[model samples]
Target: MSQKNSEGKRSARERLQEQRRKEESRTKRKRTLIAAVVVVAVLGAGAGIAALVAGGGSDKKKTAGPLVAPQGATGKDTVTIPVGKPDAKSTLTVYEDFRCPGCGQFELGFRDTIRDLEAKGQLKTDYHLVTLIDGNLRGSGSLNAANAAACAQDAGKFAAYHDLLFKNQPQETDDAFGKKSRLIELSGQVPGLDTPAFRKCVEDGTHDSWVKKSHEAFSKSAYHATPTVLLNGKDVYGDQKNPLTPDKLRQMVTANAKG
Candidate 1:
């Protein structure tokens, strides 16, 4: 009886130990499953955030209505901000982005010469505003600024506002134009531009789609890079050997005019 009791006790202890081992194994599996689930959830959230940012942060793609072309739009893809007489003999097409520092440099270097030629009615400039910088830089500043410039076009203040945009452009990485209020504030500096309609246009992003269309055209065009200056439909800065200067621009325009 004593031997039988001892054997029974040993059997009970062994059963308890087996039960504990099974329970531990089950718990570990549950914990691993939970950890795997957590890891998957974290990865999923990160991917979603990455996608959102890739899609231009919070700026949703415009999805309604026919795109309203801004004032003086020569094509669905371009806004022809007339700098000189409509009958000017030569045409200077300038493709630029508001957020591009190189574009700012180009404008600072050649604005005077371009304006002088425009004043003389020797050349007409077709300003092709694009937004490539916004895509590369991961923000909506370029798009918003271009939209605001289009709004200025509606108010007949495109030239002044355009110059201001370039003149006050923040660093390449800085997205100062992301806010609609900033664009409107800049417009106030341009006399007679701070109107209710202009404000509504800027705030409402009235020309955002048109800006996108212009960028599409720019992307398809042969000339790459911001501040692409084409004289008589030929790239003025394409030739690195004969780099363009203010004097060179004037000479080219004069020569084109004579031709």
Candidate 2:
């Protein structure tokens, strides 16, 4: 072969090798871009799920609706559901939302003791119904449930209905009490609470406004969590930043009786 032809062949080989290197570099860049996009998509999805769990779906505030105070309600917003007796020496105030799992735990844990104390006329409980979870969870279950409870109060079965509500509480993510019919059905578990008046009240959402007002009051208060309990106007769980055990609750009430 002539020297010029040989040199031309060598140059062609070099060009081919350079072309392959450039193609490989392009392929690598493309793969890197695709991997980066996948990572971003996964991160975005995770963020969305976290927002949902945190109840950040919408900007609209969660409210119980119009502000109509129930007949027997007391306190600034008339959202206070009274149990025990007016003249009871010790007052046990509770700030709670029906949709809150923590509140359910507290109720189930202390139901019997609370009833016993109330029965003995040693303790009176003021239940403040709030709708924070409804706001966070984006539903009307908390509001509806609170209204149904108020209706139960009107029917003279608040205590029974309260217990029943906590007993049948659904998962934190589920809006179980959003339907009025479901609330009425739940009332059946509480004797004498499934009357016509109670049914009408639940259906009409008579206490929705009251619940909203209660939630407003709750937001204004120093509390930032549900299942907040105060014994004789003092926080029962203040000493320990955790839930009060049955024994601790009994001890607190017993001490309150002495003072």
Candidate 3:
């Protein structure tokens, strides 16, 4: 009850409060440090996952078998399948994927016009097959169909088989074309195209490497979509604002044709 005793008691209470405040501050700092470490660890783990995914894709590409150009294939890397007379004045370069709906539409719309131009010796077409849809949709239909089309090229029935395949293209999600039997069955529709050689080519994927090579070329090129059509090295398709139609294609080829 004396003044000095009261002062001592107040001094003790103040010291205890200060000690509690310091302890709380230390605990908060420790929790903040733990949280920062967890964030860094999570970020590092995410980066490692991303690297593995990227490396797996690269490894798969590197494992593609030896390049085997299809029979009679021409152009750089022997990836082009020439459909019209080599002496034709106008050249049409086409990049297409079998499972691409846009390519099917292009072929269905221009098949007759292209054939007519070829018959009249006015235009030559260099077809470059790709497998974009297979990569996008995680299926083998595009690759399988491209290989079979290359097989048809070997039998000199490429144009016919090409048209037929586009006409019979399944839904993008459907991998019907991946079956060699389906390709062979379709080949029966083309005269002299279902021989043992053609069958073996389809079943053995003889042209798969060639198709993959062509696709790799396309992937590296400036174009990123299917049905990339060029006229005399000029981009005539892929411009939605100025779409190319069968009539326009015919007129352009006719205008460029030589006597």
Among these predictions, the greatest TM-score belongs to 1
Please state the error at residue 18 of candidate 3 in Å: 20
Task: Identify the superior model by TM-score, candidate 2 or candidate 3.
Answer: 3
The count of backbone overlaps in candidate 3 is 0
Candidate 3 to truth, TM: 0.76
What local distance difference test score does each model get? 0.84, 0.83, 0.87
lDDT of 2 by residue, 189-211 (tens): 88777889888888777777777
Query: Would you estimate the TM-scores of all the predictions?
Result: 0.76, 0.72, 0.76
Give one digit per residue, the lDDT tens place, for model 1 in 1-259.
6999999999999999999999999999999999999999999999987785676534444332358888777744455556677888888888899999989998999899988999898989889888888879768889889988988888887888999999899999988887778888988899999999998887777888888888888889886798898887888876779889999899878987787
- In model 1, which runs have C-alpha deviations exceeding 4 angstroms? 1-65, 76-79
| Error of model 3, residue 4, in angstroms | 23
Query: Alpha carbon lDDT of residue 256, candidate 3?
Result: 80
Assess candidate 2 and give its lDDT: 0.83
Q: Compose the digit string of candidate 3's lDDT tens values, residues 1-259.
A: 9999999999999999999999999999999999999999999999987775565321123233566787778898788999888999999999999999999988888899999999999999999999999778766788889989998988889999999999999999888887778889999999999999998887777777889889999889999898899999999988889999999999989988844
Q: How far is candidate 3 from the true structure (C-alpha RMSD, Å)?
A: 7.2
